[model samples]
Target: MLMLLAAGLLADPVPVYVIAGQSNAEGYGVPHAQLETIDDVTVVWPGRAQKEVGPLQAGWGANEKMIGPEYGFGQAMQRHHQSPVVLLKTAWGGKDVWCDFRSPSAGDFNWAEQQMKTREEREGRSRKVGAFFNAMVDNIEVGLHQAQVHLGRDDLELKGLVWFQGWNDYCQWPVEEAGSPCGRGIIERYPHNLKHMLCDLREALNDTTLPIVIGELGVHGSDVPKSRSGWALRAFRTAQSETASQLDHCCLAPTASFWDTQATDHWECHYNGSAKSYLRIGRTFALHLLALDALPDGQTLKWQASQKGLQAMLRRYPPKSGGLALWGSSIFRLWERAPAHFSEFEVTNVSFGGARSWETLHYADETLFPIQPSTIFYYCGSNDVNAGADAASIAERFRLFSELTRDRLPHTKIFFGAINRSPEKKERWAVVNEANQLVGSYCETQDGRTFVDLNQVLEADDGSTRQDMFLPDQLHLTERAYEGFARVMREALEQKVQSP
Candidate 1:
């Protein structure tokens, strides 16, 4: 591994990608079954700027598999840009979107363990999540360190963050409310308290500009729960896009029909996904990360360490020991603007993989709100491509996304992730590409936003989309695809664009 410092202090910014959120992002993937050698090209993350890498390492492992979303995007990017790509995996196989993994150090684990054991006994099974609880924090803390060590940078040095959650939420969300405050032990806050977690995380990392890409979670079904499906999962998956839209530096990848199965060593009951979908999801988010760093003119939200925005907001609360400020979540530490003062922003992603325009639009309205972000980077219409949807439908989707952007943000960037082509019998690649062209063309009529034709840029010289560019099933691009996608955004941002 070429060290970052010795490789020459990144003349520009290091193309760092954070792989966060639940299982899919953290990797419940099955390692490839065979020991067949592909090539370094398949293994390398994007941004390396060179191809013809040697025979690749054996990705297949007994306890695990390596075919996940980031694989391709990372390879393509490294080859394309000569930039080092650091993927920090911070996924907890089964956790809720709102649950912030709490540490034992944060509270008394004995009480938590006792209560947990009591419940397990009542249910005639041992429900000790203590291992999972500790592992979650350990994974993130270690993953953050991995990024730091690999990227060789402080706070603002890393590039972007990718989030793939929802499955965990799908399994637990229904019952979460029943278990209030998690028995008052150390509690991982919920999405309802998302601001606390996000704001605090930003403060801790000191990277307000960190682009966060959250993959919409879909419960295609998992071994964890037989009933972890149906309306609850469907509705949550539909709504997850909103969570992504609301947050800055965050984008949502459609996971509606993206997963396939293989075996894994992580959870005894969970099977690894096709890994290609994971690869595509990773790439989807990476594209936005690259875009955030690439855009030259985008304004960034700055962090305030000293009491500037919080003091005013806190004064409304009752003063106990020090002041009302002390009572509020400490994340207010760097929150410069009061909630009232913070700009009301909006974002709507205009594309989908397997989802419909109406379904996506509906979820956008319901799930996305109180969004921290102003503009949405929409990438959709893939699944629809095979469904006989025309360019008009694609155009309509973009239009709907734009309108939703207007309603929520009132003032924000509404960039579109160019919906690319799919060759499945159901999806006519040519027509889908044309629809993307239409969406790009139509977006010109909108304001504070632009359409990025990442698909055009992602194509190989041969005119055929790189096979390694997508999953074996061929619905989406692999990790390299996301890397390629991100590079396009990087190139654009390097030139100039609007930002939050």
Candidate 2:
């Protein structure tokens, strides 16, 4: 290793992940003796008084007799990167993001202020508002110092953050009445506060694009009861998902799917104190972090995050192979009524917003190949053209896409949807038209490739772009526009595609 480092072959900086939240993040699950210590990963847990920095093992939980999500999370991180990993864990039991873990930008925590006053009166000193947040930042600095000493290297990158919280904000602060004060106070503010916390942490670390994984609060399990408490939990989970969706380089690991329903290890809110539940949650978090990290340059982070959630959905409810797949950018993603439009067949729209041709190719293996759809309506390259990619390059990407699809699903038919001449890209309309022409020429020569001219329905009688067909953004389509596009697709599929 020293020789490799001297030769600059092992110069990649070590990845340091920060894991912080409430009790669950602190850990409560039981650890078995068989759990191995990962040598490549170093955990700096400053939550304890000793502030130990060492190899990750089963015992680094809330106590020696228990384990937390960090155990599996650290191991998976090390395996995925195959490099030295450092974890900075600073979590407290029964803490809430709206108060105890609140960041500076989340505003003053009134409840914490009162508690601080009381504690200061009793004791000589007390932790101020946003105490946990402050401690977390302080611990991260300490962890980095310790990590540099432990590894005998100063090159460490804060790669990701793992957050497993929401119990106290959801369950502890129940919103019984519709539009209750409690609802607005904590539940409604949860998403905003969490986003602020992440942004604030990023600013502190000076890494704007730090990847984050939020563990879904699934204490009530998959089947949340039809009660006030259940409703609160559901809302909290939604808030967490929404925050992850809105942020770049962030994803949510749905722990409800990995719920210990049988209570194999034990039973209670902390995932039934089940090691299996914690392990699964940690692994899922690692997978999401990996997905975010693996996104190619210029590929949108939120789209990969969206793909992560969509993949989970596909796993839980696998789509039938040999169906109609509408894959592309926002044009197809915003078509929520796609199923009703293509009622004739099983249609799966795996499109995402702001997706370019290259991004589609990058994500095709994981998102498109799994279904191996019989036919596809590919609507992309609009973003690419807008991004200044030449017509030839965009067309070649489509050719590459077709080749990949042919290799995976030999008999699958592909329809290259012409890039829409939307008002948003009026300046690049010339490039869009040239790219469409190039792709059309290529598709005509291919065996199973067809070019569906969407501009036919999208344009008006005078050969001008129909402004009414577009939404206010001048990029996306309106309801009437989708109707016309659907009609064109239905006709093409019926006339061109033969039944299996």
Candidate 3:
């Protein structure tokens, strides 16, 4: 019995693909009369039947009478891999990324407070932010356990994720009606929200390089009508494609070509409940997953577009020598009026959104060499902390970055900006504090190096992250917070300049 158990443990793990999202992912497809079952593929759809593991076939969609893309995805995967596969599905109808499917990294939906309060008052139920996201995680866990049992091996691996969502976000009320904090609708922030969802999902699943295949929001098909809604659909589809393009190990499966005008069960958003569309989309998604291995390394491809954009921005506004340079992630990149704050110095911002420490090092040659700035105010590591890097590792990356900067510009003074604490990252505060301490200690070792505690001004009197200072997302800072940061940084710079 012991030897048999060991053999079972050593057996090759079954590859499981998690298929999740909103209505489209849940599948409104009318089941085919004669559905073929892929015996090689097992499906654990907790959303439909609790922990019931079965063969891949019809009745796995929203109900027993429907079919989802997983049907075709499993078919294609089985045909290509010629091995046992698991389709672990968790999906819900009418979900939106802005709130329902919001990821942890995306932070709270503060702008929806009034709406939530009203709903709670009326329905006596409060819709918490990231509700669906948490549910998805829990459901995936349940599915994974069932998969392990079905495969008779504890080593079952979740190989990929297929996401098909976006209609609700695209249908968000206009700025005038919603009156959001940033004056932006869900559609406007859809790309950023979607990216965070994917990244945070990966982190939660402990598979940072897991392949993701997104079904582009091609509901209206190729011949999009000329109207307000049509234009919005085009924009939304473009945003979906753009978001997929930025992330590594992720690809978009085009669905517009598969859109059938004659296959209407009801609403157009569900691709008219077309079995052909869902099946084709699933097959296309499988093809993309197969080809994902050929893509560039995650580290190299991550934020490649933002890195290239930074280079382009620098070319357009060439940085002059003997000036100040601001380096970091989206926090610094989004500060458009940074130059206005540093009036005494020619401030050039080379920061980019979603940048990690390694990216900073990756583009050092292009960002630092040309400028040779007299001073650089650095604000990074928040992303690194979120990416699960240890404090020591973050500090080491900073040291390496400083060394590279000092090598070319020896006289340059580098100031390390303290990573700010926020309500969103409250759980990870300990890690953030440790990273700040490690980086601060390293800065104290050098004469020209300094550690600026920008977080001080951004915090409330109670020492908690000031809710008002942060944007509705609860991660990025508001203009008031940036102003405080500018004031503190300016004072710090002046004091450092005057020191013997």
Q: Quickly count the clashes in candidate 1.
A: 58
lDDT at 261 for candidate 3?
88
- RMSD values for the candidates in order, in angstroms, are 19.6, 10.5, 18.5
Candidate 2: what lDDT?
0.78
Give one digit per residue, the lDDT tens place, for model 3 in 1-500.
Answer: 58757977776767889889988888878855678888899988775653367998888877777777888889877875678889888888888887788887876555443453454467676566788999999999998988877666777778899998888777753333334433234566778889999999999999999999888887878788998777778878878877887787787766787787889675788888888888877876776565453232343436766666877877888877899988888888888888999888998888878777776765565555567789998888888877777777677677767755654466899888898787778788898899899888888888789999988978877886777899888899888988998998888888997999
The number of clashing residue pairs in each candidate reads 58, 0, 0
TM match of model 2 to true structure: 0.62
User: lDDT score, residue 373, model 1?
Assistant: 46
Task: Judging by TM-score against the true structure, name the best candidate.
Answer: 2
**How close to the true structure is residue 442 of candidate 1, measured as C-alpha lDDT?**
74
- C-alpha positional error of residue 166 in candidate 3 after TM-score superposition, expressed in Å: 1.2
Please give, for residues 84-145, the per-residue lDDT of candidate 1 as tens digits. 44444445545543333432333333443345446547789743433443454355455555
> Of 1 and 3, which scores higher on TM-score?
3
lDDT of 3 at 104: 75
